[model samples]
Target: MAKFPKNFLWGGATSANQIEGTFLEQGKGWSTADIDKFIPKEQRKSGPADNLVKRADVEFAMHDKKGIYPKRNGIDFYHHYKEDIALLAEAGFKMFRISISWPRIFPNGDDKEPNEEGLRFYDKVFDECRKKKIEPLVTLSHFEMPLNLVLKQNGWLSRKTVDDFVHYADVVFNRYKNKVRYWITFNEINVLEMSGFTSGGILADNIANRKEARYQAAHHQFVASALAVKKCHEIIPNASIGAMIARFESYPKTCNPKDALANVRANQNNLFFSDVQIRGYYPSYIKRFFKDNDIHLKINDGDKKILREGTADFLAFSYYSSMVAISPDATEGEKLTSGNLKLSFQNPYLRSNDWGWQFDPIGLRIALNELYDRYQVPLFVVENGLGAKDKLSKDNRIHDDYRIDYLKQHIEQIGEAYQDGVEIMGYLIWGCIDLVSASSCEMSKRYGIVYVDLDDYGKGTLKRKKKDSYYWYKKVVESNGLIL
Candidate 1:
């Protein structure tokens, strides 16, 4: 049996938009995430909002050029941050992973100077974390891209966006150079391949030449990420820069070689993005797939060098489920693909979240071993949790044994991987509090160890209540692992 280092980090993770509700406060400009709440839930193809967005209206006329109705306010995280952070601190989180909203810093996307007001917002948050002695792991871009840039430049489709993104990174790195350290250039670099909204902040349903656009967009992000890493090291010499990938551990349906082949293909599709970020070039399989699909990326010579020179210091992955890849067979009753996986309910044995993410703890060990073997870089479990529905008892306590079970089993696997010689930094649970869900925007699919009472219908108190998992997690962090 092996043990994690005594100083190994244990904590929770969240994005700015999902948790920081002061969407348009303190002179903050409207980000792409802010506009998303105004859009209808079903129209949110990538990640639909549950109940928060619908009841978010607070009656203020925007007086747009088209004279449209004003948008609603978010959960008001700006003011409630102190309360929330205290809860996380009480839960024994040694590290807190959060993204800094770029629009808040540079309102119109490209700016000669960052807003002092916006910079101060993060300073306060960081100061609070420092007070609690919690290490801050910041992601430069995590789903929240400036709206003006996305609409004007088609997000990463234009090369100029890459340069602009690097500028944003430079500004942030310089601002927090001495204080906050761990940096992730881009969150889930491959998400842009699947969902343009997530990848590029684009909401348009009509995407002209989507495959070409996705690859091109991804190409720009890869370059931007590399540039950010290079600039961050310059600003902060000892920065441990990493690239976060949304790793969905895939499995074959059966022992058949054909079924296993499908799983390999699925894994390749997911890994195509990481291969470039970590390996510094496109994989042969991806190149061939692009050729067959007529998807071409415009990469300059400088971009190649940037990628090669600034590879990720570590790999951060968000593991939610283990998807079974099934081969198309006339005899096999059914199969699961991206489109049909939600409706098919293919696997009955595995447990699923309210958002339909399969809960698999063994998948963590499998993913860690695979990643360690391939990249040989230290692995960080950036995001992993079970999104469930929790009810507060009359005694004002929320009992979330489900969340406890979910994280405990996952943490057990982390220990197992350590025994297997996989170098791991820490485990950051998805949401420390009930924040917006990435898949289904509904707050009902809550992931936080601390339960926020406010619901979709807007009836309950906006109080921070500790769930059973809170105490369980506190013990895990104090014990350094699940000794109990």
Candidate 2:
């Protein structure tokens, strides 16, 4: 039996945009996720690209009338919350992480009043969690920013979006103040550069200056996140607010000095966002980086003060896989893999998933130690899982031993990290139930212990069945990870 702290939170995570299928239902407006077009597996031979320009190029692909918009029908979880929550309770979930879709509350991003129907919907969901004694960890904004915000304000590029996001945060924080104690501001906030359209709603190709636009939008998010943290502390007493990042750990491909230095630089770039959120100020090297890139952020009056005053209570991040960094002059073939919206250089020693995401369980331990050494704050692993093609057996069960092996190895690594003195507050597996993939928008790339009877083309009965990994994970949570 593996051991974890008694208070450790064990649960699953799903964002509203990925699972809640009712995109246009009950006064909900269109989100960036809603406009995402699904590409089939056969056409995805080159794999999912993480560049902002490439993502923006596909923006108009949604206009095709015959295109399958899979996000619009995300396994119909919007209507199946009761059934889903019941299954989670049966699996012994101590916590359940979810995101409140911004467009759902405001209908449009800049609305003065939130939609009553959207607010009531979450009320019932949270009430159900409370009935089952499951703590709800809520993300204020995921990738589903209102499409209206992008069309009207050019997304977070305009500072007005900051105020709009703050308004939305204030409404949800107050509404679910009692129900949700854990709040994450901006999911994977650091991915703004690579995923501007999805992360900040900035259409990369349309912008005259892409670099400046990305950084400025990121600055607005930083300010907005800080403001929300301050507001949450004020409105919801004892609430713990965290800043989330996509933790892309990097290692030098070789022992050469140049390779090691490149790895350090790569890591610094990845750690920049959390540094500002946790430390409450920009790192000194950022000024030189910004100057070298000819990117100047517009910092308004009192923004620095707000940022300094409203630091996050903890750090929450998604660690999928680590990348290898090679020097500019290094002679080696670049083996690129896809995961977490970043193209990673493949590590020779690690095994990779079917999607080309390398599996390095030790990377989780290294990331935990690195983050703890840097921030000295409590950490929550909000997202980590293997997305695979699942097949159901004739017995009406998914014998997904591969998923079980993936999770078990990661859990063992997490246990080792805990023993190494990392203060891990929780672990929430990404996409607890099958949902639409954010990068590829494909439903076939499933990542859930509980299998949903759905297909890539939106065919099937939409029935929920527990995979073999479901019972395996239930025992893990029931024993507080000891059974792992």
lDDT of each prediction vs. the true structure?
0.76, 0.88
What is the Å distance of residue 322 in model 1 from its true position?
Answer: 0.8
Please identify model 2 stretches exceeding 4 Å from their true place. 45-63
Question: Model 1 RMSD to the real structure?
Answer: 4.4
* lDDT (Cα, tens digit) per residue for candidate 1, span 1-484: 3467887899999888777766467767767665443323455465322211111121122223222111223345677878877888887889999999888899878887888998998999888998988889999888778766766776777899987898888888888988888989888877776777656754354455677887888888888888888888888999899988888787777799988888888889888888888888878888677888888678887778888987888999988777777776722667333310122224667776655567779989999999999999989999998877788788878888878888888888889999999999999988887876554445776888888776654345677778888888888888888453
Q: How do the predictions measure up, each by TM-score?
A: 0.90, 0.97
Model 2 is weakest, by summed lDDT over 10 consecutive residues, at 48-57
lDDT of 2 by residue, 1-484 (tens): 4579999999999999889988688999888888777777777657544435344444565466788888899988888999999999999999999999899999889999999999999999999999998999999899878888887878898999998999999999889888899999989998887777888888665676787888899999999999999999999989999999999889998899999998988988999999999999999978888998889889999988988998999999998888888898874668677767778677889988888898888999999999999999999999999999999788867899988898999999999999999999989989989888888888889999988888888898999988898899999999888887
Steric overlap count per candidate:
3, 0
Best by TM-score: 2
The TM-score obtained by model 1 is 0.90
